[model samples]
Target chain A: MYRAQVRVRYFEKKAYDLFLQNLVKGTSHLAIGQEAIAAGVAAALRPDDYVFATYRGHAHAILRGAPMAAVLAELLGRQSGLMAGKGGSMHLTYAAGNFLGSYAIVGAHLTIANGAAWSARYRGTDQVAVAFFGDGATNIGAFHEALNLAATWKLPVLFICENNLYMEYTPIATVTAVARPAADRASAYGLAPIVVDGNDADAVYEVALAAVARARSGEGPSLVEAVTYRHGGHSRADPGKYRPDEEVAEWLAKDPLPRYRERLLASGANPAVLDRIEAEAHDEVEQASLAAQGAPLADPAELERQVFADGGATWRR
Target chain B: MATLTQVATRTVTYREAVALGLAQEMGRDPTVVLIGEDVAAAGGVFKATAGLLERFGPERVRDTPISEQAILGAAMGAAMTGLRPVAELMFADFLSVAHDIVANQVAKARYMTNGQLSVPLVVRFGNGAGLRFGAQHSQSVESWLMAVPGLKVVVPSTPADVVGLLAAAVRDDDPVMFLEEKALYPMNGEVPSGEHVDQLGVARVRRHGKDATIVSLGTMVHRSLEAAAQLATEGVECEVVDLRSLVPLDVTTVAASVTKTGRMFTVEENPRLCGWGAELASIIGEECFYDLDAPVRRITSPHVPVPAAGSLEDAMLPSAERVADVVRRALG
Candidate 1:
């Protein structure tokens, strides 16, 4: 769990650096401080389980086993990228890794996740579909619709809301009616409300394990709200100055990376082993960045490919 | 017509064909599932999907809440995975509520994922005006989907075409928007019994003539044939072409008819602005510019919302008389 969080942190930082160097084009939503939720939830999931994430999904994709180099190459718009530069950072999809997709539209993937779960149940498989979104998504129509459908149909799925307390530039508490966005709405769907500390990896993993087991057993869906924060801006553009300095400082103090390291050391974990993991994570990120930067841009002809299943963009003959 | 196989035939209404088409595909492929509001047990709001629930059972023919986003989104997700889902949008106008799923997620998922996924799904909806249901319930929105790539837009004119084309759409590897004309649901036509399937982009020449070519789709195809029959009594024989599918448009048949006739007219039910006929007119202008003896004409509904009153709607929508009059004037 520590290694996964460290790898996400290192990869996000390198991506931020690359953005500064103007190598990563377009926009990217970084999940620097919210790594524990991704790492923990993924840790409890089997490799074949389906995962649907939002645009801020670099951490989720990496923790779901998408190669770090290919993810970086995708952000860099390289030919060897995860989607051949068709989908940039915001739309990373590694279907082979069971990371179904990172949807850019807010709240849409929740309903789609229900479809995956429905497919699993129909096929007589125990595979659970997990959809990760932000607190703002809980207010969208698709979110409510998805919850209602999943609950009514008893679909095998989990709705994980990373309540970072902010909806883009505004505090979620200001716009939201209830104090807890996702957890507060669980009862409306007859689901048990679950809220966990996003800064604590172990807490998230435990919650995820219970939810996954319940879903696999066909107990319907679960809504889990992970209280976390984003250490960086919402995207590459904003500096996240809308947040109060004291709140930012408080969340930074609760950073999961160093906090986990401290917990491990106090628990009698070897210092050299932790050091090696951290060093290897850093080295992996560095090498991935180098490899992604060295890769060539996608061919211009690829623009007209794969619009349909026939592997062509031809709408008319 | 050339793409269809010889088989036993039975006369059925368009509404009955909708249920028959669904049952045919569901019986053949267990993966094909039907989902929508009132689609099961209640048959359907329009009674087009009657007997589906009892035929396929609740697990396969399930009813959903009045959630358009959930319906299309779940259908898209299921299609992306393994199941071939046929989602009904209830009304085509409701498509506006869940346009993002159709235009963005379903249409672009294959391209965005770089072919890593394929959304093999069909979104069938009740389309066009004629029921006096007013503006909200009536619309011909095929033009709305024609502009969006990565989607196959199919609007069948006859009962046989509905059964056959729906089979084609169900088995298609891409997402398809199957628009069923609400006005023609009660219209009876001969449909083949047993298994029936048709190609997606093949346009059927309903009536062959040489004086002029009249291209139409959905309910307008019947109106155009009526107009052609009327014109035949006036010493003018018009060739009527029914463009069953819009996305993979059968330009070959329409172009050939226009080239032989030396004139063309498009009868459309959609509003005037950016209608499917506009694209067909542009294509005709570009491809058959020199072959034309007269300028192409499009008899369509005025750029106005479909009104509730029958008289207003009849005057607004392009009728058989209007089509024949336009063709006569253009040919003269």
Candidate 2:
């Protein structure tokens, strides 16, 4: 869990640097401070368990076993990218890893996750599907519909809301009706209200494990609100001037990476082991960035490829 | 070789054929499942999916809430993973509510994934203006879906084509929007015994002629055929063609007919602006410019929302009289 969280932090930082250098084209939503939710949930999931993520999904995809280099390549629009540069930074998909695709449109993938779970149940398999979205998604119609359908059908799925206190640039609390957007609505769907400390890896992992176990055991779905914060702005365009300096300082002080490191140290973990893990993560992300930068751009001729199953975008013969 | 006389046929309504088509595919492939609002116990609002619940049981023929987004999204997810799900959007206009899932997600899933994922699913909906259901319930949305790249749009005009095209849509490794004309549900036609699977992007010539060619789709096909029959009495010798699928459009067939007849007219139920007929007219103008004796014409509904009144609704749709009048005037 610590290694995964460290790797995510390094990868996100590298992505930020690459964006500054104009290597990673287009916009990217970074999960710099919300690494623990991804790492912790990833720790509890099996490789075959399906994960549907939002556009801010680099952390989840990487933690779910997508190679950092390939993810960076996708962001860099390289031929060696995850989708051969067809789907850019926002739509990263690694189906083989069961990390479904990251949906750019908000609140759409929630219902899609239910479909995946419905399929698993229909096929009589123990596999579970999990969807990760923000607190803002809870207010969307798709979110409510997905919860209602999943609850009524008793589908084997998990709805994890990464309540990062903000929806894009606006503070979510101001726009939201309920204090706890996702958890507060859990009762409406006949689900237990589960809110976890998103900064704590162990706390998230415990909650995720319980949810996964319940889903796999055919006990129906769970809605978990992981209270986390985003360290950066919504995207590369904004400076996040909307957030007050005091709130930023308070959250930065409670940064999951350093907090986890201190937790590990206090739990009697060897300092050398921790140091090596941190160093390896940094080196790995640097190597990935270098590899992505060196990769060639996707061929222009391949633009029309894969638009249909016949390997062509031919609409008329 | 088996002769045409050796094959047995049974008459069935378009509504019955919808269920028959679904049952055929579900019976053949275990991966095929049906999900829609009131599709299970209620057997669908139009009863187009009647007997599906009893035949396939509750597991395969599942009923969903009035959530179009969830229906399409779930079907897309199932299709990507493993199942070949057939999701119904109830009314064609309701597609607006779930347009993101259709246009952005299901349609682009395979393209975005670069062939890593393919959504082999069919979204069948009741389409066209009729039954006095007002603007929301009645709409010929083929043009709406045809504009999207990754989707295959199919509008079957007859009972037999319904079974055949539905099978084809279910088997195709892409997202197909199967638009069943609500007005043609009770219309009956002979369906041959055994499995029926039709190829996509193929147009069938309902009547062969020499003077002019009449191209149509869905409910308009019947209207065009009626117009052609009326024209035949006046020595017009008009040919009628039914374009089964729009995405994989059968332009070759239409072009050949236009080349032979030296005139082409498209009769459409969709409103005038950017209807499927407009695209066909442009393609015919480009492909058969020299072969054409007269400029291509499109006989379509005027640009207005379908009215609720029976007389106004009838007037809004392109009737046989309107198609015949348009073709007769253009040919002169």
Candidate 1, residue A220: CA error in Å? 0.7
TM-score of each prediction: 0.99, 0.99
Task: Report the CA-based lDDT of candidate 2 relative to the real structure.
Answer: 0.92
Q: Write the per-residue lDDT of candidate 1 for residues B219-313, one digit (tens) a residue.
A: 99999999999999999999999999998999999999999998988999989999998999999999999999878888899999999999998
Q: Write the per-residue lDDT of candidate 2 for residues B142-221, one digit (tens) a residue.
A: 99999998999999999989988999999999999999999999999988788888888899899999999999998889
Best candidate per DockQ, number? 2
lDDT of 1: 0.93
RMSD of each candidate? 1.1, 1.2
In model 2, which regions exceed 4 Å deviation? Answer: B1-6
- lDDT per residue, candidate 1, A1-317, as tens digits? 99999999999999999999999999999999999999999999999899999999898889878899999999999998999999999888989988889998999999999999999999899999999999999889999999999999999999999999999988999999999999999999999989999999999999999999999998999999999999988899989999889999999999999999999999999999999999999999999999999999987789999998889987665
Worst-scoring 10-residue span by lDDT in model 1 chain B: B1-10
